[model samples]
Target: MELGKIERLLDRYDEGETSIAEEKLLREYFLSEDVPEHLRSYQLMFRFSASQAEEKLENKPKVVSKRNWYSWTSIAAILIVALGIFFYNDSSRMLNDNGLGTISDEELALQKTKETLHMVAQIMNEGKSDLVYLKEFNNTKNKIIQID
Candidate 1:
């Protein structure tokens, strides 16, 4: 190829407007031993590309299917839904069976609360009686020690 034509192709290649055929021609021109000194710097780049194209991988690449990923994701979603349903039903059943369901009568609830509070009060009063005896014993011990 004429030097002028090669220079035009190089300009087009630099501008990223060259067709594949033009690029191939440039590569061939650069790879020749007769490349002019001014264009010799570009020979290494073309040689490197040619070498890369001819190079082969030692091991073939492994290919994974998209369907397998989808299957696992689907199974996980199903398991999560199943677990949620199971816990919801179990909790609802426990609430009804254990008499923890809705209590509609406000009066009955108030009466139950009063009884519970009364029981707690009685237990506290019994403890208070024991504390009274403890206090008397401590007072008598202190009086005896003062006399000695």
Candidate 2:
């Protein structure tokens, strides 16, 4: 009841020797309106602790159903997998239906002709590039092996 006793109890509390019930008692005493002037300094601290202990309607968190959460997640995963497979199969079918499918005899002949033309063009370009490099190399060698 006295501030000195309360101070001693608080000292014991600081040393971690006070029980939960003793702490509650201290909180109740401090929260009371008639708290002594000497103990007024601790009123806020005890009142805060007391208020913290009181359960409020808003304190409890909103609960979600685990079964529903799992069900939705599974459905989403299945939809993603199904969509991936559908798109992949559709693209494969599209590619086969287009000109990229296995060539017939006439298409094979046309493809060969196109390939031959491309090969000839590549060979001609490569020859021109090589000739340019060869000419530069010859000039460098001639400079290095300078004649009288």
Candidate 3:
């Protein structure tokens, strides 16, 4: 009978031996209200599976925020390089008229070196005097704080 064929199809379907046509027949039979009481569970299962197949994906395409920081950074780098080249060319063109790149006069260089050393020594002596004041301040702080 038709019921025996349906039972055989169900067994074949469960064993993964049913074709698409067989599955469609099974679906059609289970979806009908005339399904037997004994096979109600299969009908519910098929109905739920059918409903799941009808569901549409709720995934809406999201608009991601794009950043052009690389473009801006490249523009800034190009401007910096352009400015550097311009300044380098300008400075090279404007060399001092006095062909005095290096102090060719040894005596003048020695005099200049001595003057610079004297100025540095004077500043260092001033710093040493300030250190004396700092030591006095530290002594006064220790006395006021009473940290024996």
What lDDT is reached at residue 83 by model 3?
92
Pairs of colliding residues, candidate 3: none
lDDT of 1 by residue, 49-138 (tens): 999999999898887789998999999999999998887755555555547645679998888889989999999999988998899999
Query: Largest TM-score belongs to which candidate?
Result: 1
Cα-based lDDT at residue 24, candidate 1: 92
TM-score for candidate 2, please give it. 0.49
For all predictions, the C-alpha RMSD in Å is: 19.9, 13.9, 15.8
Per-candidate TM vs. native? 0.54, 0.49, 0.40
Candidate 1 positional error at 118, Å: 34
Residue 7 lDDT (model 3): 95
User: Cα lDDT of all candidates, in order?
Assistant: 0.89, 0.83, 0.89
> Which lDDT tens digits does candidate 2 get at residues 1-148?
8778788888888899999988877887787899777778788887776678785677778789999999999999999999998877556555645577456799888989899899999999987887988899999999889963
Compared with the true structure, the alpha-carbon lDDT of candidate 3 equals 0.89
The candidate, 2 or 3, that scores higher on TM-score is 2
Q: What is the lDDT of residue 139 in candidate 3?
A: 93
lDDT of 3 by residue, 100-129 (tens): 557878999999999999999999998898
Question: Candidate 2: minimum summed lDDT over ten consecutive residues — where?
Answer: 89-98
Mark the regions of model 2 whose C-alpha exceeds 4 Å error after superposition.
33-38, 52-55, 58-60, 89-148
